[model samples]
Target: MSVWDELVGQEPVVQTLQRAVEDAASMTHAWLFTGPPGSGRSNAALSFAAALQCEEGGCGHCRSCTTARAGSHPDITVIRTDGLSIGTDVAREYVRKAALRPALGRRQVLVVEDADRLTDQAANALLKAVEEPSAYTVWMLCAPAMEDVIVTIRSRCRPVLLRTPSAEAIAGLLVERDGVEPELAGAMAAASQGHIGRARGLARDPQARERRRRILALPAGLGTLGDCLAAAQSIHEEAGERSAAIADAADERELDDLKQSWGVEERGRRPTGYAGSLSSLEKDQKRRRTRLTRDAIDGVLLDLLSFCRDVVVAQQAPRAALVNADVAESVRSAAGVWTVESTVARIDAIVEARESLTANAAPLLVLERMMMEFLPR
Candidate 1:
């Protein structure tokens, strides 16, 4: 299995990068990889990095390829952040590392997996490094869309766009790579609506599948105001739970690091600046928790949008293959109840909710407003 094999449904991108790897002249010093969530933008960037380091151009069995893929290569540095923003300090550190010569590989590779999350200061710091990179250095930045990156930074890098894989392609990969049964794989692919990671999760985890099922069932259950409010509360609670789980471990780790930095024991005298440091850490934790909560809620909104989209499609073209095909009957029923305009309105409501969440609106309140919009008159 070569490195390219893991990048499902990106044959054209693979070919282009493979050519670049074989011909150094075709390779650029900086690259921007843009794709939707679960479309493997980061995977593509990392695969290219591995190929650049490998003597045989990403031969999966090679030592360089294995180490790069495992994220242990001496000359490869990947930055991924769990927080809301990547600060100037981290970006400067990456820039400093990028100036060094390769320790083991032929070229040093720097990858930023969440370039979209870089603060303005951080982006500026990175921009300088990208503008005048070392001869043997390469930078790869991945984001959800080209527009997510600053225009100045984006214009300097070669852009690689990855499309969402087709359902057939996603299902095939699930069967081939993950050993999922074909029947289950197809269902998951349809449910995931071209998200490869989401399909894999749904296929492998019964809990994930059940959660999706409940979410998908929501559209058909908004028959009354009471039902709509109940649905909203349920989704809000689910988002809270998911966000807490995602942030709790990271929060604990940050607290531990702060404690170690202050040389403070469980019941010891407080050191100088300890209170200030603890306050700063708490502020960062709060920001992270808020961001995680919004992200979790946004995921639920996207799923709701997909379901609404299927209803609109069913209304317009009754014979079309729906994304949520398992719920075809419910979708058809929804199409009957909601005119095309109303279905579109529901989608708009979901988008508005997402925007509100990004604006730091209360999550439960935003969800409640959206659910009320879904209620029948």
Candidate 2:
């Protein structure tokens, strides 16, 4: 029920944050929390903010804890970005707000969920506030890594780095916190590869687990060039579907706003310029969709690589559970078919796929090449 309870598999972080809140020895007005996706970087920052602002130092049952966790607290301001980047204009507004006195709590706390997305101007705008924040202001920025934030801003902030927790730790949280069955929680935790969010999703959604099942089954099918192409196509299709699902709601809202601007009702017919503008908008949406799909596929590729790594680890170090424990049989079969050197090469291919996608190479091209490279000699 406490805000700390929601942060699964982060006991060390929780302890540190609690100590800081208890002793009032938290350094620097600004804080940077870095962790991989699903590691709860933003969640930790906000929880720490709540704890700091709470008169009782994060009394789990207090009004401050409840409001802070629900994102309705007066003294805590959280900014989450849906767009590609957070520009300078918004950064300045946050900085100005940080200078103000607390409205309800001991400190005015600001949490930026995607500080890495801050543009150059945005980083600069934030620099001054971080350098000389108000006595009552506490700023927390969350990102994937410390290097992603500007060094100038980073140097001025206290840093919190979260490691990926073990499967046992993640499973324990799911059972104790979410009231999930112990066995099912362990399975999902194993499959999540230390990502608490993905573990929860796989635990809650049978379909997501099924998707992972289908994907893990793919290595057995990559027997020919045609099969590799088919595999690549399936990945592309799935990613497209995932991205379209994300973009559909936002796209509809944008179209509605355009109609309102043109003084037209929802069902009203539009004129020539409207159609042309819509076409351009659709084109932009398509590009964004493609980008998202490619990103999703790249994530899959990374997971696949993790499976291979687990196989290597299992053979070389049998004490550890495979990173792809969900695909243990598949990994065993793969390990049988290939030598350790070949498995390493395949991992290299996965890295190449990631690089290609990030560098804006065509998705199909990168995946196709990766599949070919992964094929047994």
Q: Give the number of the best model, judged by lDDT.
A: 1
Task: Write out the backbone clash pairs for model 2.
Answer: none
Q: Please give, for residues 1-377, the per-residue lDDT of candidate 1 as tens digits.
A: 88898788899999999999998788899999999988999899999999998888998999998998888999989998877889998999999999999998999899999999999999999998999899999999999999999998999999999998888999999999999999999988988877898899989999988888788888777888888888888988887788899889988988998899889999999998999989977887888888777777787888889889999899888888888887788888888998888889989999999998888888888888999888874
TM, every model: 0.95, 0.88
* Sequence-dependent TM-score of model 2: 0.88
Per residue, candidate 2 scores C-alpha lDDT tens digits across 37-137 of 87889889988988887778877789888888788999999987655678788899988899889888889999999999899999999999989988888
Candidate 1, position 131, lDDT? 91
Cα lDDT for residue 80, model 1?
Answer: 89
Superposed on all Cα atoms, model 1 deviates from the true structure by an RMSD in Å of: 1.7
Clashes of 2: 0
Point out where model 1 deviates above 4 Å.
none
Name the weakest run of 10 consecutive residues (lDDT summed) in model 2.
280-289
